[model samples]
Target: MKIRSVLSAAVLAVAATFTSAQAFAQDTFTLKMAETWGPNFPIFGDTTKNFAKSVETMSNGRLKIRIDSANKHKAPLGVFDMVKAGQYDMGHSASYYWKGKVPETLFFTSMPFGMNAMEQYAWFYHGGGMELMQEVYGAHNMLSFPGGNTGVQMGGWFREEIKSLDDLKGLKMRIPGFAGEVFAEVGVNPTNIAPGELYTALERNTIDAVEWVGPALDLRLGFQQIADYYYTGWHEPATELQFLINKKVWEKLPADLKEILRVAMRTASYDMLVLSQHANAEAWANIKKDYPNVQIKQFPQDIFQAMYDANKKLLKEASASNEQAARIVKSQQDYLAQSRAYTDISERAYLNTMGTVE
Candidate 1:
């Protein structure tokens, strides 16, 4: 009887160990997130790292994210395709980067003379814009979250000041997405070059001008060093960055883990926008101190107006031809109308009154 009892106890112990091992195996997850930006860039890289950290911490080590920055795994522009193909679980990118896949993707990135960062966020979160954007991504077998926003971008860095319409003619610029379309309309040839090639392109006269994120990232990339003139009038009033994930991978996440990812991505998105705005403000001041020779000019009113007109026309034309484009634009336009109506009464008035104070 004593020998039988001891054997039973050992059998129970082995069964318990097997159950424990199974539980531990179910608890850990490893995911890959990809980005085109170098790991050293301030907001993009740092934000990506924070996302991974947030997921790991929120999961209490149950999930781990490995960020593949720059060309660590694949070329940056292939982020969306890789995520869609399940090569990478997620991607951080500008929706416009994949504009070739879906011409309408540019609208999700920016609209010239369109909403600012805060208003765009409001439209996405509360105005149903997010759902509409997801609809576009859904066709690509992906889902996207608003990952970041560069409040208002500089028109671009030009080799020379653009003082008149004539000045823009024959200028070859490294601009992308819809703004590139607008530039083309205005007689500037726009080339879409990868971030890694921008500096060398600008240096070698491969491109006469280039527009990048803003003072923060652009200055760091040394664009200001190669280009003499910086023009601003919101070529891209607000540019939204996106995080895309394979739909299958997203669906497979445990419910709790999915919620955590959503919350973490949104938090990181908001934080990145606010941080970039502040950093750009500081960088502007620093640029003046260090590069006094740099010419900073508000784009001439006529030039700004012309470009705005071209962009508006392009938007109207694109929406009419593409059903998906029309849907996203209608959603965005409706939100903008409602938002502007409310803000005109409060925000616009406050700003006008404040301006008169001094």
Candidate 2:
């Protein structure tokens, strides 16, 4: 009789364990996401929309993400703060935007002479980028992930051609991130402006130049019509947007759901980069065909040299003050040096060869 009682209790405990596991797997979650972009804002907006839909679909309705854009929240630049304070469960914005709050955050976006999209994404995943990013944001009670990538960005739309470094002095330009600091080092007055206001800012002389994404996005703002000189890209190569999640909120998610969110974020990010390439290519062709007046210009060698030197100087200054920043810089420089070697030999060499042949 005693043996029978022991066996019955054992079976009941196993049943209870199975039931708990089932309940855990079936748990439902609906997370709220706040974005920096306004509603229906092209590729950037599509990233968030795709991610939300993917999360729900992949999890079979166990997880859902509801997104609110800048217009809804009335805080275009408040994503980090809102998510950190738990006002929002997650956020979609660029890491560099949080430079004012955490200096190390800027490195996660893109540097002036940084790696290209392929190389940078490798660094983020295979390299130490993810660990470094977590260390920086961990103190702030948030977890940040690579949300999307805009590959290489154009220099800016300038009202006048930058004939020399002198032309850069006192120039009010709507530029952001670490590149802005580099521009400031070269005597340009760097300012940040929301996307919706860029066209008016330039037309009214509120800003002298604007460095937006690329042909795809810049064309939408009508910069080609007003700014006659469309400079080629040099500042932001592999500009990466980030997804922010509150630490408490992240911890509350089950293991399987956490993995689902990660896969969804990564997939959406890669898709955005592909979309950027297609859209930029299409838009560039259109600009050449329809907007012949828009002249594509590259900065003179001397101007490029000056900005390059200034970028180095600014990086040195940044490293001197903060150990964390110093470590992050070293990691990126080390990785860049290693990977750029292969890139030059392979990608760069092939492109050069193809250009000469065709």
Candidate 3:
């Protein structure tokens, strides 16, 4: 009788252990996101929040994302390091911010005369840019995806027009990233001013000029009131926003979760570009109506060509000593070669025929 009782007890214990294991396997998880921008800033913070929402809905409660904007839990500049160290799961920031850490990270974000937002999307998603991007970021214990792109930005607001390359000489301009290096080469003194202080710097004449986003964001920020001239030929071309995920966190995610993240990022990226396009159009019209003194001018062809040529030379010089930079330059040039053929034939031709309708 005693032996039979002991055998039955052992059988019940084995069944309970199996059930516990099954329950543990079925449990859900959460993802944390961080960003270096303020919350609710259109084209910047909005897309990140959109991503958080989309991931939650797609996962059907199995996964939830908590987004913390700049300075919420850590300093904005530390976002990359924090995410890399696994202090946070993910982050949203401009690729230019980390030029000091990884000089080549700039190519993934923007080039001096690089591809436009649309062409960049094509190159990154379908064109092999994504593969090389992985290689670069992998070195820093990160996984990245295209979060958003600010489509062609304004030439930047200035107290005076830049008629000749000489005009750039000795001018203190507020810009960031690799663009700063190029501007410096052209004789402009580049200064890094936080967003909060940008307006005061321009208003008080502390900085000669500042380049923010397009009219949509610029007008909203009240730069139109402070500066006399707003130029159209954006030197920064297209600013690609990045989503950085901690390498370990990325690797640990189940395959399904990883797929969800990639798809969500792509969706957010597309939506951001579209949003910026419409917003800029409306803002431009409204600005012309409201601010009559704000002179908007296209860059002269001669000046544009000179800057473009200088950009090429600067790129070659910068990459000469750095192999990774060389790889990025090669990839960018190759992708541009392949993409420009189509762009020139289709988009550029159509725009030329239409001649800036609206």
- Per-candidate Cα RMSD to the true structure, in Å, reads 2.8, 4.0, 2.9
Q: Which residue pairs in candidate 2 collide? A: none
TM-score of the candidate numbered 3? 0.91
lDDT of each: 0.84, 0.92, 0.84
Quote the positional error of residue 30 for candidate 1 in Å.
1.0
Q: Considering every candidate listed, which one attains the maximal TM-score?
A: 2
Instruction: Give all TM-scores, in the order shown.
Output: 0.89, 0.91, 0.91
Clashes (N, CA, C under 3 Å) per candidate? 0, 0, 0
- Please provide, for model 1 over 1-358, each residue's C-alpha lDDT reduced to its tens digit, 9 standing for 90 to 100: 9999999999999999998998865667788888878776688887888888998999988888889887586587889889989999999998888777888777777787777777788888888878888888998899999887777888788887888988889888998777888888888899988777999998998989998878987888887777789888476777888999889988888888889999999998888888888999999998989888788888788887888889889889988889888888888888887787887888789999999987
* Model 3 lDDT per residue over 103-135, tens place: 877788878778888888888878888988889
Estimate the overall C-alpha local distance difference test score of candidate 1.
Answer: 0.84
Candidate 3: worst 10 consecutive residues by lDDT?
A: 22-31
- TM-score of predicted structure 2: 0.91
lDDT of 2: 0.92
Report lDDT (Cα) of residue 54, candidate 2.
Answer: 85
For lDDT, the strongest prediction is 2
Error of 3 at 234 (Å): 3.5
> What is the descending lDDT order?
2, 1, 3
